[model samples]
Target: MTPPPMITDRDRDVIERYADGATLQEIADGINLTRERVRQIVRKHGGADAETSRAARQAAKEAGEQRAQIEFLAEYEAIASNLAHQGFTRAETVSRISVLYPSIDVDVADEALRASNIVFDQNNDTDVFSNVALEAGVWFLLGSELRLKPDYAWAAVNLPQELLDELGTHLSEASVTPDELATVLGIIGAAQNAAMSDPTLTITGARYNELRSELLDAIGLKSATGTKPWPPTRQTLQKRYQGWSDALEAMGLATASLGRPKGLLAFSEDDYANAVIDFISAAAAAGAEPTFAFYGEWVKEQAADGTRRPSPASVRNFYDGWLPALRKANAVVAARSAEANLSVE
Candidate 1:
């Protein structure tokens, strides 16, 4: 009753193979049937198959185990770029993701992290420090830059619960209190700022453990066995962060945002400049001082053909970067016009 033999040809082939002294396992392998099913078929065809030779069975068992191991490994990949983009080591991104997605086993995450080291070596990348000294050195400099005490006396902040929730602070981490949450958030900002100041300082070790150990050591924030101060684990950082966006938001710093930042226009830089100047000139011609709202309306109308390309934040940046240049140009034009009039007179 092996699902009602739908193919007579396949059944005949199995019977012939069994009659030719093939072992049940060999026939099953070739015909894609379970060995017991093959054995039953062989018994039905007038002669019983021989017992599996012990040595062959052992080999089959090893082969099956090897196959399983190979398949299990396929559950994760060890690519370097994959790890860097995830920032697995510094942020405990893997652990957090595992918490978020229950099926992602920790072993798989570890394998992926280790694989990144191999990939990093193969790719000849130096984004991560080659030695603990360098990583520690970087951490000391970064912590100093932010003026954070290894003990969080002068530099701690306290956010309300709503902001804490928005920052993704889970209850599990010791960051339950506001000062605790602020201390870690401060560290994250400090790290980001340090990376900005020196691109090499970007966290790049293949795993969070390496980063955690290095940073804690450098800052003398020992965990579990030191006299000075205990440091936050990578897990703690993850409890309050979804990445730079949330980190910045939590700290009340400027941000690009989860979606597109407000006020980025599709206009080319030159077009954007012209629109700003035109908006200002039009406002002046109307005997009204140019303002951010007027410029926003100009951007809205110019980009209205299909989309509002420039976000408000980006427009604010444009105003910040180019308005002074426009003012300078206007001043120069006025000076040249005055000189020409004097010469003509």
Candidate 2:
């Protein structure tokens, strides 16, 4: 049983406002709560029937429209300016913009770029970029810049190695270290996961270097997913993270250590709890039982859903925490009901 949220006088005022004809959305916007949460509170307090005034509804609509327009204009200007300096292929521009501003839809950006008559001057000098065959040794990454950077694409070259070597040096198990592979992939995954900024807070240099070093190791060792064992198209670290579980599992690599993921970024208690609750709620909504096994399977299931995935450590913490809390609450409620029945007799 989940415990109730602590409601103060401010919460009562929000309900009162909704009962007096303010929309649940308006109340939510004003009080910084989600509309669903506001609606739940209003319903619990018998305020669901109240309809907001037409004027208030119009005002809310206008506010939303205005905010959207402002956002669109800002996004358009930014993309147009970027296209002017970093003139790239249409697809590359789209990918670059998407990586930089993750919230911006690729299609929407593409349409806007076309409509704005913004043309990208192709990188004519990329012809100077020759394909260098990556030897099976550790490669060093000197900078923090990632795949989106203009120079980043040139850092690690994926050359043609279709001609299998009799020595089996390329794409061979003798050269692959599963533990090292897991560690590097974990770090690269963590890098892409942490590397985003616009909407995300910045991480520390120490953390950044740690991730960079692992990526450097992969690049140096030619152990990166696409360049080494995996397909060449699996070039970006993002690709590896996208195929994190599957690729590792397919290679018969152990993921038990990846579960702890301390080599990655730091996650807070609130973040962990939220991830746990999200999994439980989503599972329940899907009509699936929220067991450890169910969540474990869900986590391993293929596809990058862009959700804040929990670690094995997080799963254990959730199991040890929420289950006991739920049972204790249930026991308290049962005891209270029993006491009330006895008093009535």
Candidate 3:
């Protein structure tokens, strides 16, 4: 026959402190008890065996870590899958993933594995998957119970296939084609170029560099190969322009006039309208725009002149003025293109 469990005064004290929201560490400190000893008492009184409690805590920690890993892997998979869908060359995908997930070395390894056609079979029947599934399932069930969203129920109820198909369809619609994205990128590049060229456009050097790099990347332009302080390469600029031109053609707009200097400045009615809409949408979503900062000897001069205080109005004005003009120009060009098409017809 099993011996009856011991009910010591220390056990009662630990339970009371736990009920009062004292953490295991805190409870241990208060009663001059070690954390392990306190944990033992709490488990015994709470109807858990010492071994069972240790296992439970270990399991919980493992589950948390696995969840985090899953989320990371899911994000990595998303980027790879998106690039694949967008018709990016495998090399391009690898290059882009390397830049995006620099910290996640697994991406680099996975890319190599994918390139080499080395496949590893995942054992679903293993303890890892079973623990992960149990934890994830519990979370989903609890969330569904609280929110009562039919979609969550559907996710939980359906076989993995149905869920996968639904997810795929959603992803497909959201996936941007390289050509389509390149056009939007082209416009942004033009805007950045205009900003950098205009003496009136007062932005921080860091912000300018960041925006310039982003624009270069969007158009598939490479940064300067060496450490020289020279301006961006002509070849890079040309490639970016080509990307933009391609995007313009894909959008059903005439590229002939837009491709020429001062071409974007002129527009037809339809083009003008579309440009206005696109500009407005882009401006509204311009939260991602980098902020420029000022420093160096100018900072001391400004401090001495009592002009060091940042002005919100100056920042707001830049966005308000430049974005509107770009939008109007784009619209005008679009409208003119439509008219030219009609004339040709």
| Location of the lowest summed lDDT over 10 successive residues in candidate 1 | 222-231
| Candidate models: Cα lDDT each | 0.45, 0.44, 0.40
State which candidate, 2 or 3, has the greater lDDT. Answer: 2
**Model 1 segments more than 4 A misplaced:** 1-147, 150-163, 168-182, 186-345
User: TM per model?
Assistant: 0.27, 0.19, 0.21
Off by over 4 Å in 3: 1-33, 36-40, 43-47, 82-345
TM-score of decoy 2: 0.19
Ranking by lDDT: 1, 2, 3
The local lDDT score (0 to 100) that residue 67 gets in candidate 2 is 61
Residue-wise lDDT of candidate 3 within 227-264, one digit each (tens)?
11111222222243354333222222223433332222
In candidate 3, how many Å is residue 7 off? Answer: 10
Of the two candidates 1 and 2, the one with more favorable lDDT, higher being better, is: 1
RMSD per model, one decimal: 17.2, 31.3, 25.1
Better of 1 and 2 by TM-score: 1
Clashes (backbone N, CA, C under 3 Å), per candidate, total 16, 6, 10
How many backbone clashes can be found in candidate 3? Answer: 10
lDDT, model 1: 0.45
